[model samples]
Target: MPVERTENRGADELHRYYEVYETIGSGGFAKVKLGRHIATGEKVAIKIMNKKDLGDDLPRVKVEIEAMKNLSHQHVCRLYQVIETSTQIFMVLEYCPGGELFDYIIAKDRLSEEETRVFFRQIVSAMAYVHSQGYAHRDLKPENLLIDEDHNLKLIDFGLCAKPKGGLGYELMTCCGSPAYAAPELIQGKAYIGSEADVWSMGVLLFALLCGYLPFDDDNCMVLYRKIMRGNYDNPRWLSPGSILILNQMMQVDPKRRLSVRQLLDHPWVVKDYNSPVEWHSRQPLGHIDEDSITEMAVNMKRSRESTTALVKEWRYDHTTATYLLLLSKKQRGKPVRLHPEPAVCEDSCSPLDILHFSEDEDAVIVGSLDLSSEYIDDCPWISVTQQGFRGQPDGLTNNKNVVCEIWDGYGFCCVFCSKKDRDQEQTSENKENIVVQEKEVEIFALPLPRTPASSKKNARHNKNVLTTPNQNANAINSKPNAVTPKGKKNLLVIQQMIERLNQTMCFHRSRSLDMAGTGDSGKKKRGGKMFGSLERGLDKVITMLTPSKRRGLRDGPRKIKAQYNVTLTSQTNPDQVLNQILSILPEKNVDFTQKGYTLKCQTCGDFGKVTMAFELEVCMLQRPEVVGVRRQRLKGDAWVYKHLVEDILSTSSI
Candidate 1:
């Protein structure tokens, strides 16, 4: 008889079942590559984890795998199987050919409202499932979000996934998340509810999806933290009322007020004009996904898993699973590649310092000499711009406390606004010459480079005066009429003229209507009482004229006679007057009143950021202003009513 070859292979022989191709991606402890099934020509993503890299954190890796094993959702990345060998562990997952959502968003600059709604809906669905599984995906940035060929989102990267301590009131204290998407509670180093923290990240994602850039961002960590804590950001005017309403609900600074996943599902924007996939609707409703239900399901699953484990242990003659892992590793043999630990930052002597000063000649000051002796400096790839000699600076907005600093190719350049606080801290000429750097306060502002030719020329001139003019005070530099570009000035003038003309036309028409109503007649004013009173009484009279007898009597007349007899004129509150008064009181410096709403820079915050507000202007002018949404305040009274936005309004229409 011919010798029979056995087809059965143990878990250690995973390489026989699948063929690993070239590496596709990599992280600290794992490398992902394309793999093909031996039995079928199906392709899959194989994540190979080095056993040695796990060391003490092996349990966490196992937990992540276990969590993924239990998860089954259309929007979530699917984990097919786990295979272990002597030196490595392999995870077979669904292949997402479209790559990361980060790259997609970057290519598009920003997504339109329709596309954002679709992607965001899928994200929320995945998040709801993850939460219901009693797992918190601590890292939920765009990099963790993937896309398939069909344009559907696939949530991946479960390395930071974890179970909450308890059913309710459970808090996670780990300061483990991306700073850009981290919640305020997490940033403060305080314990935070995992679900609430996840909601906060969703808010950041939503804002970034609609706007091209992040809502809160800065080169300085402390500045970014402060902005996040204060919930300071501008509302993009292009967003619809519904979109703005939803964003406001999700991005609450207070976790308690932030919309939960269930609430988000039920929100108007999420549901409006939205047609859910059949699979999505077939799953349990959001209301069924509560903490208690998840807790019970988790307990049951754990119990079943334990019983299965016991049965397997008994079949293996009471040998623990850990022993099997060692046996499999020994069978495979050979050590995996060892990765170096992350490089440490040197905090000691010869620190890298960047200083900025304004002089008249448009020249930048570079004070620190590179230490060629230090290994750190030798390894540093920073290309010195000073070697190229001095070049003219770009012209742009230059004002007090409005400076921006940016770094390119390891060299730092800034267009900074010197504040009174900074100016007050006077230094000796010798001290200034030495370029002493301070740790606590780095006076850096990263002004964005001008894109247009006109702005480029303007910025170049402005930067010359800002950086090169040593004797010229910031006040003198700020006093130039060209402080704002001629084009910008012209746009503001056009917008203002548009508003003024609209106001004028409305006022003229309103006055004409009032005269027709006899309110403008001095003799009729005494008889008419207050303008509002006449309006109310006229409305009541109009209502009375609509009685059955009056209707029959009016029906018999010609169309013109019936029209004249059916309606009565009355004085009303002019929207033009309301807007005119609000416009009159607003500072001309940085305020722009547009049809959508108004935008103003907060003088009180001082470089914190700009604030944009959008409302139905006609509705606001007609009703009692009162308190509005998202830090909006309105002052209502008999004499004058105006909504007071952030104290200082900058005239720049760039926002």
Candidate 2:
């Protein structure tokens, strides 16, 4: 299906990136067409709207764009890109194949308690996340809730969304929503909190989901308003007790008395079968990039990895970022891969004592044994290094009398040196040193075993039946040629081979670190001093780079604190005088404002006319006649832009 470019210049521009197909939906001002990305071949919903037709409702479109741009959630429909031509604006959105929840409910007539619970939980989760982001979905109905191919709910249509700059308590005067879903305060034309109004709509949505009909319906708008104001609605006999209880609390006529979105989350009906609470504020920062997605984009798009990374991190909703997101979504929909594979285990069941022993003769050094079970050995792989040649001779010995054996069992390292002469001299000797090396994730324990008593030694001699005389033992200890068992010798050879491999690995890392640190020939100078210093610094840098802390910091980048967006100012002037000063200053600063009493609704285009920033400023007289409060609320656009606008207004105004 090809798009007709004759009628729309926007379609002609969109045809360059997307292949527009049949119209999936149509409204009075805009039409949504099913389109496919030319580069990635993934389907998208392209909403085409003409500027002339939108006219007064253009700001609503801008509000929708701004809201969707800042929001990223699993249950929220994503806006990929926005293409604006001279005559039209094209918004590429996530294509939901399962259609609207309204149609689903109509087809089934009414949902069972269990099925309704599932859908309601998803709606609540999405709304909770939206409210936490400081925005409220004023028009939350089944028509705006879409179901995807996997039957998960996705909240859409943020045209009427508002972010109260004065926090949740800030009241909005807009009474524009579906009459059936509108709260009593909205119907009464009274100022109402956005979140509370949304809660009321959710209660109505809940009723429709379980009862297959509106709680308050009338052909006459006046009668409907009366019923809503009276807070009178019939609960179906089939509705559960928990459902009725929550519905009553949410549908309260007074906004202040109504259950809040946060409180509703813990309601019995909402929490039923919802064992795991949704993490509303767990979104990754915009600067966080997926390495796999970037790599795949680079390969498929024939672009450099560095360029693709920069584009994705910018998150400007450009062609490159859109394609990358599509590829990433497709990958996420596929089967999940395990992050860490299980380690392989050795089949041999030889004990540590057996592997440590090098000779079968009675005069061979008896190294301390590790009584580790086969299961324990299988769980923790061990690497043993035995250096037989001694560097220096010890006291009271003709030859070097110490055997140094180092064992690494994944988490810890142990080094032991045992000598027969030392054991005889001190029967109750115990020497142990524990050293923790956090960077290497290893703990070192150097321990020397105690000597056996005379009685135990005599019993060991009786059991072995092979005891050497003192003179013979002295010769055996001094001798260079001692017969080693084949098993022990093979194991000893393997351990020596492992030690060589470990040394090679360490050298490779050291060289790489030095090169990365740019310490070329200077790092190798003065082997005793400068070399060690350079090596230590280089190793520290390498270890820090490889640590999990670096990855964690990258993954959870700097988040935007909500407090910065909520701006308020105190003035000593009268409330009316302060508001008049703001109005007078806004026009000079290229800001437009519509005033009603002491409140001024202001808007401006920013980011080179790419974003439309809308905010509300209210001036209220304090208890002191000479003092007033100036409060600003961000209704739409970027938070930083709103902050700068408020600062600019305050700086230029005399108030």
Candidate 3:
């Protein structure tokens, strides 16, 4: 899914290198374009980041460059260059061969078990390398994972990598990240380890993939948060045993317990040899993990909170924007609770005024009494993150419901959403026989609410940055800033080579002009001035978003990028039979195709052929949809059984 660059033609002395191509995409913060390097005659993806516009968070750009250089793997998105000037920062990266995986999943109705495995294995392998290097990919989701021509995954967007040990204990007061996939603890206004956060997201991604919807979902965010905090979502029977196993571990309410990348790699779902369907068969019905586990996580959230607090405090600077201490407080008198603290930059706890117990370990915070009927917590929350710090919760506790909640905890503030339920609360609690299930204690602990001290001396607001370690009468619990430059072996050349290949392809049939910004003599460039249409210029842009939108629907016929191509489904074809027939003829080089809906291929010859069931589908806990939402199938409260789909892959290949 290479970006299609329309030429931005210009003339200048610097134009000695490849010509400037057209813009692929643009947002307020940055713009990306496709270019052909004159020296190498190669096509490349170039992203320009505006320095002043990134607000005060300059390190993110640096983090991205640093991460790309140090981390390299086949499945990992390749980084090519980091060109920095006093005014700008230019990042050159290897283009992802395919478009956003988000769009991909939407189009395919999700991949088969084997397809999911191929994707997971590649991504986890990339993550394993990333984690082993002593860093955490604070942000992980479908959007960041790019696919190449071979359907290989490449993890991109390292703007939030946290050095596990070496980080200058700079307190990161400003919580920044996507909320939908944030871990439960994060939503609870607690400190979280970077690795722990990543794993939580992995669970969300997996759930969405398997179920074709978010696991714990709500249009109203508060409702969503409540669901997550409960940590009591349902896993559908349709999910494979292997997938269920990984989802169980990755989405653990507690970060410490959340499966590590390495651990996940070893799980039956991730490991290549394990048969998912078979394992699900012999297993007994899965049970709901003790609801207490979520509350337990609330207790363990100390690490993320304390650590992030210490990091922020340690990095206190005199800059006005960095100063300001806002304490989170709850209104004692309102049904619709709202919080208005000293207003400053921070991660505000997402909970409303309703009092509730939360277990720190699982990062699961359960709150009761939300008016979910009208307004849902899932729709919004009381607090939100602002550049200055945390603002009042986004949505007050307006919706009324009587269930616990889940949250996305950030540096200081948090966002909450409802989790997918085992069944609506009515069904779960209505049955007298299920009393034992309700009796299980949720391991929530009482925490000291941060409040303004009425009597304690008010520390004068100095440079608002609170050092992690204490002052002169001190120990080093904080990090100081000299702005250490992270050094790493650069992998920019690989990106350059790939780009060059694209440039050659673009030029193969068309003579396209180039462009430059701020240069005096501008050159005139017209669309399709070159012979090859979008197909040609697009190859030059590696990191492109490919969707049916661009191809004018499947009716546009099959489209090919580089050597990569997609075939169409026709009315005459028997979907299952076609898939099976296609897989059967593989030359033992390109496929280990499965009828259950996946295929493995030999790279050299593209011939690994049709596969037989190494495993069968066994629902560990198959329940009615009303019972389970989209949680992994393993913990479905006991009941699951077995099937093979490899034959379809063989048949499909021939079509």
Candidate 4:
């Protein structure tokens, strides 16, 4: 029985159809509520999200919805309906009672090898189906895997999934997901193939399931990263040899050496007791209609069969289609996995009549109607006809006047042609209507293109510069010249030559300034050139200002204009704690600051209170797990002063 909703009539429209109950889960911008459909009394998880709270992540939500809509499999969570309002968006999804796989793993401490195999097979099957549909689940972990009432695994949370339109060779540039489950390439911020990255995460998940802990874990994020990069993990002795082999293959340091989802499906460990092999080549057509489901929907909605079928075929995001799919899913429960269904046989004894018309202008026969049955018409409402002639015409035809005509629909096309003279002969022949049916070839999946060594080296160097730790800065700078191309090297050489000439001119000016100072008024009178003397003095002043001081080298002067004036301080504490520590010490340093989340903008005086300095300090995760990075930015200040201020703050804080 559904709960009575008499609280409010104007607040939510979803309440009219679904009886919303207590919240089951919540995130930063969304809350999942247990909802029951009023019409069929079905349990559902309704995710309610505020548009404003979503901000830039709204596109990710839309992508998740699109990916869910494209996927339909037993091991994948189904998206039932989506409702949007002016300020909010609601997504109704399948409710799993067994909760997350992470909780299940924790409760059991560790799963047996046989149980792990069962779960791993299901995950591989789902991944195969996902890849076949041209999508990759970038975020694969125990937390994102849901379990149904029957203890079957169902993949969820496709917010980070990728389906590139640039085909299989396209590389994903986003560095996402948890560090424990992330691949080495992703951690290094390199462009990676979506499927390969997913495979690496799957390896991590398998390890966690078998051992009850992460393969790579450390309090220091940098240490954890180094471990993952080197593929260092301890395999339990209790694990079988096959399991260990598969793990090593899946978690290979090189993505190309990693085993793909297809290969994993056929692995000995994965297929040990799994008798049913996934049919990777089979593709279910989107326009497929189920007669039983349609009949049930028609009865439940109290509508005509034709109208229900029309609504289901329309496939819009409305109540009728949602109810139809939900009912269909309910009927499919406990059934054997069916990748390909046998062709339907017509019950009635009505032969398909072909209606043809001859076109004199084109000198060809056009097929007007191939199948007039209600089912065929409903499946493909539009028809496109083509004419193709056989190599040899029948003896009854004169001058090959009659041509074979073919009719095409959405699913497949059929050919039907005959001559009036040989109509009886054709009827006597075993094949009627000379019809030939041809099915469209469906592509299974695309593999990634091979990468060259040169490209790989270039990407590695670029990624190093993009995401480099303080310890690697010196090495990166030293090796930078080797990465330059011939053209870049030539340009650098030209710039060096110009700098040397400038240095020589400055040296000559300095010597002239010293001589002029010693000679004083007598040297000016000897030169007798006021313009040249004044220009020489101006050049000397400029050179003096540019020269390094005796106490500090030129490197300690103002930072290069092109160089970024940022210092990233790594802290073991959380972002909030590090932020608080910095905030606590700012007041003591006579700095006025404004705080926004983990970022702070500070204003202070530098250079003996003569220059006002302003800078920003941001505490961020920087993609490192359990580590915080305090980054500094000189918004309006001397770079040299900002650098010292950052140093002072780090020294004063306990972070």
Candidate 5:
């Protein structure tokens, strides 16, 4: 489907690069259309929002864009750029072909513990990164999480994101977010810290993921609020004791007591065995809400409604201007009603002592509650990356072969890169047909991971200045290895090239142990105090004894420092399928063991096999312990080249 071209020359001209297809998804006032990028032949999802329908939410739209533009996490939906016309705004976003997490949950009822843990870890990592940058995703739910073709999760919908002024952590006072996932502070309409509230929502999400239902759901709105406020919920028998412990801490009634993102990451249940230790950044203080921004939003809300006079009359100077602005915002979106008649003001005080009252029907539509009646797409087929190949065998090499790389192209799209050979042909067919090319021949390539989102103005300016083009992108592939300058932040093309070079650089060597070195004041104190050192050693031994896998794995010297890298496996292969392939080739005498960490470790025919069953990869690497070398197991006699994967993961021992 081509773009619905209009006479308004501005929009038509802007959309020329894209051939819009059928609406892939829709939201409150926006619709997401599948689009094809003419220049790159990349498939993208363009979210179009009409200026006329935005009403008072216009400021929010700007804020949402501002918030999303700066974020570049692998788990967060990428926003490429914004295109505005006289009447509509187009947000070019990454297209997630796997659809929503909610749909998967509905289909599976509940996920296995290992599967849930993989997704939960990713979400926690993303939240930790975003919180470190001083932004809060106020609305987090299953519906807001999209699964990419690789089954990797991407968080979307930043319409309720809160960024404090001065780039610090700030308390959000607004009664927003979905009721089912809302924290106690949000439900009670209290001013609460953003990250803490996020923790509560995550707890709710985890509970739902494990149990296939929300912990605090109720038909009556008031009953739900009461349940959330009291931290009232039952623990399902199926939930692991470790999981229950973490959830208990996250869903605390008091915001202050709730687990911070850092704590959540550090928790034993979250870390387990396979997940590497994350070095969390220092706490960034939240800034106070900008009065000017709040005031501008309030003004927009007033303009949105014609009869806000009665609503304004009920306001008293008792609350902060920010609070009043939020109240006005609620009036703009939901039911229309008049506030209670003016209360008699005490001569001694300027502020009123009583709270404003609403009429019976309108009272239910108060702060902290949003209408959960919106229609959402839950039937979209799982769009996997593994498609049928032309005939014979598919190209597996990085150079001079049939390669189809998925690019997140800022529009949440699974776009395929076009080789120079196909460029002319693609250009010729741009007008007559939609550029929905299923496959493109290209050199073997790795997509660059998105840059981390930063909140500082300096980072924002840097992002704005970078200009990327297909010609410049080609240079990344063809250019010889050199020390690239960071003067202009490295774009996706440059980063991808860097990874290709890295794959050629690494060689087999016994990685060294990086345990604590050179006795400092802390080390000296521990050594001098015999009882303290003994007590610590005793505790460590006790912990090891209790954990069977850790004890067994470490019995021989320290466990070999396993190499961890980031790679999105082809969509055609799932973990189970890959596991079966590896098992087929294993010797009959293979001493295979299945563990809680979704890992299969075996020793067979002089090969040490470590298979990780994850959404991203179906890794089955055989290590020859005698030579201290690693080799990937062949899948159906085809070389599964993983050399292009970037080694961004930190080793637990090193940290």
Candidate 6:
């Protein structure tokens, strides 16, 4: 009889089943390499894992194999068998002759249209299979997707997979995904719906596939979340409509609103427009995937992800399973590389809730809601520009007891306009006479370098100024008799926003007005400064005249008014007139209204860093007859809601 060779259970003696091939990878677990079976004469791949390699995860090897077995779509790699020994476990799996999807993206910068369609189809197929099997592949990023010798996909990593029965809409609060790829619901620390969360990940993948960049691209996180919620996308005009349609439907903001896998399969981008929809795969409306392999592929699945069972170690009891892994060194084992963490500011700081309101550089401000549908508060003392800067108290709008402003705070709205100006940062000149202020210049705050939106941006040159025009005709009937109900009235807030922007144009031409006030040595007197050219007093009289007597005193000198106004508006002329004219045409609200609807709050509370302020009043042009030239009034009516915005330190006085 011929001598028969028997396999041994020891670590060193078990190398007989195959000849080791070159190393493919060595990571946190163990080294994996290509090998050829000694008796079979065919190529095979081996993943060697030490008993310690499994750590707390040792028992889950069976669960991994179980999930891998269930994930058998054309896009998912298959796990074949397990071998064991006292020292290690060798997992034999289907090897992808090709590599990772991330490499392809970096190498080509982006996927071409045809390439995207093909890859997308494969991804949808994989998603459908896993979901149908009642499982969710939570981590579906490009790197987790691999290609085979024929460029087929192999989605691996079963650690985060879960079944959909009790698992499907369940919330995964584990802040576990990458920030750039994370969905808004995830970042908010809200409960995340399963497959829907996966869809958001898919949306990110699609965006990167097309633009070679992220859609929510921003360094400042608060700003980034605002942009994401805005969802105003500029598609590269170059893309085809079919792809756009699919992406539009898949990326719906509401989780329940997104497309299902089967619906996505029927998507025009997936199947041609001429093709009919794919049939439901299950019998309960969506017939089950009545495939022949279903029964044959079934395996015992009492495997819990957190199991303490030593399944893989038990499999290692056979000699052949314990081969070459025993010789691999620790250095040969390492974790796979991952993307670097995003910048700190890019993480939690940004969000939709932080937007205090939208600024149009006009008459009244929209207190909240980005679309400006929220309420508009008007009639507060808006800063007016004079030759010195602004009117009201000589210190301009800086005086806290008088001046007020609104800023965004995340939770609700906090009034920041109440803050005092930075006295340390103020300009110091002994001359102080003339209530010295800044010169007027056309400055555009919304240019590309400082890059602001075109709609919000104005040119540096003065655009056409809107002169005060009487809207007497429309106002007569529309004011009361024709007065519409709240529903019928033009959004007063909208009207106010327009007025606020238009007001920018009316800023006073400081030097020109000082000439009218008086040009002489009287301009220099200390007592003279307040008593200057004015037969009455210097800017002091102007301050008192503009101050709201019933309440707070004067703010900074009027020059402060000019600076704030200039900073807020692009061109003071036409934009101003346009805003006022629009407001004048607005239908008045009916006094019969009884109930208040709601209040809008600033959304980005986290972005407000601590701040300082400054104020100066600039007198400009000759006094106006119609207007009080410049006037200040205490907070009243709807505007009172925002009066808390200004800081306590600001009082009616020149700093």
TM-score, every prediction: 0.42, 0.50, 0.41, 0.50, 0.44, 0.39
After the best TM-score superposition of candidate 3, give how far the Cα of residue 52 lies from its true spot, in angstroms: 3.6
**Prediction-by-prediction clash tally:** 24, 1, 156, 0, 17, 101
User: Could you tell me the TM-score of candidate 5?
Assistant: 0.44
User: Which one wins by lDDT: 5 or 6?
Assistant: 5
Candidates 3 and 4 compared: the better one by lDDT is 4
lDDT of 1 by residue, 1-655 (tens): 2111111122223443344444445554665666544323345677767667768767777877877766767788867667654545667777776667765665465899999988998998898888877888888877788887568898987877778768425888888778878899999999888888899899888888887678888757799999999887888889888878887787789999999987877677887676543124314221222233223323433545445444334422111221222222223234221111211222211112222111211213221211111101111111122111111111222223422222111111211223333322422232232123243333321111211122224334423433221222223323454534332333233223322322333344335456656535663443222222222221222222211122221122111111111011112334334334445544454444443222111221125544333211221211122211111211111000112222222112111
lDDT of candidate 2 over 1-655, digit per residue (tens):
2223333434434654565544445555676766667556577888878777889999999999999988888789988888875556789999887777865665566899899988887888889988888898899888788888688898999999998888767889988878889999888888988998999999999898899888988757799899889999898899888888988898989888889877866777777777665445535435567788787777655679998798688878867667766766676688321111111222221111111111111112211222211111111101111111001122223233443333322111223343434322222111111111222111112121111122324334422321122223223212422333232233223223323433433454445545646564653333223222222222222222222222221212111111111224355545557766777899887877776545577778655874377767766534333356564555565433455567778778867
lDDT of 2 at 132: 82
Error of 1 at 393 (Å): 71
lDDT of each candidate versus the true structure: 0.47, 0.58, 0.40, 0.58, 0.48, 0.40
lDDT per residue (tens digit) for residues 1-655 in model 5 = 2223232333443333344444545444666766544333345677777877778998888888887756656678766546765567877777777677865665566887788888898888778877877899988887789887568888988889888874546666887888888888887778888888889999999988898778987757799899988998999999899988989999999877888888877688887866665544322111223333344434645543223333333422112221333333234335232221221222221211111112211211111001111111111111111111001112333243322333221222222333433332322333122112335331222212221112123323522322122233334333433322222122223334423332221111001001212434564333233222222222222222222222232122111222212212222223445444444543332333333222233322223443321111124222222211121211111011111111111111111
Q: How many backbone clashes can be found in candidate 3?
A: 156
